[model samples]
Target: MKKMFKLQWLSVLMLAFVLVGCGAKEDTNKETVSKEDQQVEKTSYKVKDDRGVEVEFNAVPKTIVSLQPSNTEILFALGVGDKIVGATEFDTYPEEAKKIERVSSSTTFDSERILALKPDVVIAYTTGGDDENLNALKVLEDAGIKVFAIKSATSFDDVYGDIQQVASVMGIEDKGEKLNEDIKAKIAEVQAKVKDVKAKNVYLEISPKPDIYTTGSGTFQQEILNAANVKNVFADLKSWPKVSEEDVIAKNPEVILTTVNYTENPAAEILARDGWNSITAIQNKAVYFIDPDISNRPGPRIGEAVELIAKAVYPELFK
Candidate 1:
């Protein structure tokens, strides 16, 4: 009987050992899984501007508001039109952009209306004497709305940078980089063709109403003129200068490019003006019409503006 008891005790000790080993193995397996999950993962990106300042954002913003037409156009070109929830009423380009909720017309906007949209970001241009725009945006900001003010771009590189800026905001840095490269190539080709050509004196008319609204130094339109190897007659002017009929005739530009929104026949319209026939542009039939939205807006489409200006100023070279 004593021998039988000894054997039973040995069996019990062996069973306890097996149970403890199994429990320890299960604990180790669980610990291994937890450690794997704790590893860091990369999900977002960082963008630095010309100033070397970095801004970090989460995933691509699902809801965006373009407080300016320029911003709306850039967002559309970046394929983020569907993500935009609101824009200014003047955002008439891309045809489909007009269908979005409009925040304002021209320089006037509604702060309360924009506040209701609850956008992840609001973009605007601070160049056009629209201090009221800043004020309206403050309303959104006070309620925690993210406002991104895009200062007016003054050169070709500035346009490409603006694309990168917008793309970075939309959380698509790769797409922006590709767009910048494509624009740079187009610009290089145009410059190569027009390098030896003479720089023509040109006047870009924004409005033909009471007088003429022509670009001055440090403006987007002027940048396009510079890119096309044309010298702006009003380059000396500091602001968006208004020219009288006498003033334009006296300047006598070699080419006159007006926005199509001004009139259906820009050439006829310019020639019909008093004393305009005396100008070389009218006599030589160098007058042409460009899209107002593209020419005026400092966005991804500015590259197109350069091409259009090149064609208008020196069609022979481009062709």
Candidate 2:
């Protein structure tokens, strides 16, 4: 009987694609882990978070505080979101997130509100170890809060590891294993679709013109493009670098994808770039928008990012 429930929940973990990255993380939802799984064995558990923040859990965390959306997504997917007593203002995916107490933001964290909640654990993110991130961790740790810092993630596998970390802390390893299996299955499905397709040259823009920031190697967008059988034009660059329009024209990308959503028409705005009409993407009208949330969130919806790119770069394959 125990084996059967374990198998069932393992499958449940896969079906839920709610992963989160809490840095600019400045960042969703899915089925919960269920109340029945909330019961934890009264045993000591110790593990290190991504940042090497060693955490010891004497018992399951009863009141968890998520400082970013990615941690929030991971917790929910592990079937332990109900334990969340506080989340950042940016946490929104499963709709139920909106109803939770808003406790932090991209620029500032309200230590007072967090302390008020008396969370058993506070999961946070360190985006390249900025001053704010360091201070936030210090403030909470100094206050006797068991804060665990999840390092800034760069790929999908990291997200999976993160889910396991959170689930382990919550004492739900079966659900975590199942969730990893599910995510891998979805990724395989995405890859299968693009296996034989010819790769297209792609350029991903997180922000619009003037300060166009594009990802190079070691970024999630590059992986999505790779999975979708598309090549990134800026793969030669490292990290998120500000790119010049002249270089983009030289790259001759066949498809242009942007996460920028400020303008009324995202595609049209890309099409209107002054010197970009000569680019292959503009000439063929292939400029498209991918929800920044899906591509950049570092959670379960990563498979959705691959699917969307596959369809955009090679519509025929999906059709």
Best by lDDT: 2
Query: For each candidate, what TM-score against the reference?
Result: 0.76, 0.85
lDDT against the true structure, each candidate = 0.65, 0.72
Q: Summarize candidate 2's per-residue lDDT along 140-171 as a digit string, tens digits.
A: 78888898777666777677777777766776
lDDT of 1 by residue, 1-319 (tens): 1110011111221111110000000001111112432311223544443323343344446798886666677778777788888876667778989899977654355666667788777765443333444555556677887676655555666666677777766655567778778777777777788889999989878768575667789666677788878999999996467778788888999999887463578767876777678889989988888876666666666667788888889999866
Off by over 4 Å in 1: 1-58, 128-130
Highest TM-score scorer: 2
Model 2, residue 4: C-alpha shift (Å): 47
